[model samples]
Target: MEKTASVSGAQTIHKAISLLKFIARFSGEGARLIDLVRGMEIGQPTAHRLLQALVAEGLVKQDTSHRYHLGSLVFELSLTSGHHFNLADICTPVLKKLADETGDTSFLFLRSGDDAICLAREQGPYHIQTPVVPVGSRQPLGVSAGGLAILSALSEQEAAAVLKAITPRLVMFGNLTTDRVWEYYLKSNAVGYAAISNRAAPGVKGVGVPIIGEIGTPIAAVTLATTISRMTEERIQEIIPALNEAAEQIDVLLRQF
Candidate 1:
């Protein structure tokens, strides 16, 4: 009976975590309970029970609109886990400096498995904003400038494997087929940064440089996003220096820890 109970507990924990990830994909817009049940392919009653348990643990919260969103506990745990060598803290200053220097939104994305997670963001002085991907959101590598930069830094064999794994998720991004991803990879390798114009978002362009570690491994990328009108050839040339400088600074800092 005790062994059976332990197995059941493990299964419940797995289900709860899966549910949390599904809810996190929605980010600011909490997911509806019905949608959660359907997405998880679980009965309404079982989903409700699992959710209630999560709510009790403060890992999930139901909004007034009956939608569930990730709770404060999730953020708190993330903070605690990375407190020793925090990527956000290390990249925040670099992001701010980039935004100030270029007057374009700056972002830091860290490679997490085959996905890239937005670890920090700094808004520029421009009145118009490009809300392509929010902080804390996860996007498949090669789908965004930052991700593509990191992807390009990988070895040929490693990059090919990652692209194959994430191909199914690339359909949502315009012109992000496997061949197109390789094109971006080659461009990034040639220019020392990844440049994408009107790819992730129309009228928005970006340039990204990989943050190389002490051992010459890329662990993250620094990117600048701006309006297409502002991304002229001259402007892109100017931004590359700033992006590369910032990435170098971040790399140095990362090596310290």
Candidate 2:
């Protein structure tokens, strides 16, 4: 009886996790029950029960329109400071300094659900800068150096889930596959940062470091973007320290609030 109960509980947890991921996929507009139930193997009754349990745990919330959204507790667990964070504003000074020091355009990217959003950019003195990703653009969380850095900072399981969620969007990048992104994540994890080239734009190169927020969760990334000419293997090695320092500085500043 005990073993049977344990297996059943594990299945329940798995279903709940699936439900959360589903809601996150459609999080922008929120998710309705029928929307969630459609095409999923889990029946409506089971999903509703799981959602209620998640809601009771503050992991999910329902609105007047009966739409489900990830709850404040989710942010609290990741950010710990409620909903008032201005990650770009907080990281601008570091971005400017990084750009000035490296002569490569610096970008601040915030993790938004399964996507990475470019919140701000600081152009360097380099006349041939490559700001391929403009501010306010969004991409899957394992696409560029910025997103890969954020993915590298997450726990193995969390990173895998994110990779699974973003696999469909990865195809738009020509050569990006879930396996390729996972390889990038593994490399970044081993090397303490992320670097990518010629993917976001031809001849573009970038190095990124993840910013550790409250509770040690990676909430953003600081990426130094440049042309391949300026970001050679030697320069990438040289620029990593500056990027790490800037990420640390941003992390420290973010904790103050």
TM-score of 2: 0.68
Best by TM-score: 2
List the pairs of residues colliding in candidate 1: none
CA deviation > 4 Å runs, candidate 1? 1-80, 84-86
Question: Relative to the true structure, how large is the alpha-carbon lDDT of every model?
Answer: 0.81, 0.81
On the 0 to 100 scale, the lDDT of residue 208 in model 2 is: 96
Q: Model 2 misses residue 27 by how many Å?
A: 27
Stretches of candidate 2 above 4 Å error?
1-87
- Judged by whole-model lDDT over C-alpha atoms, candidate 1 comes out at 0.81
Number of clashing pairs per prediction, in order: 0, 0
> What's the CA RMSD of model 1 in angstroms?
14.1
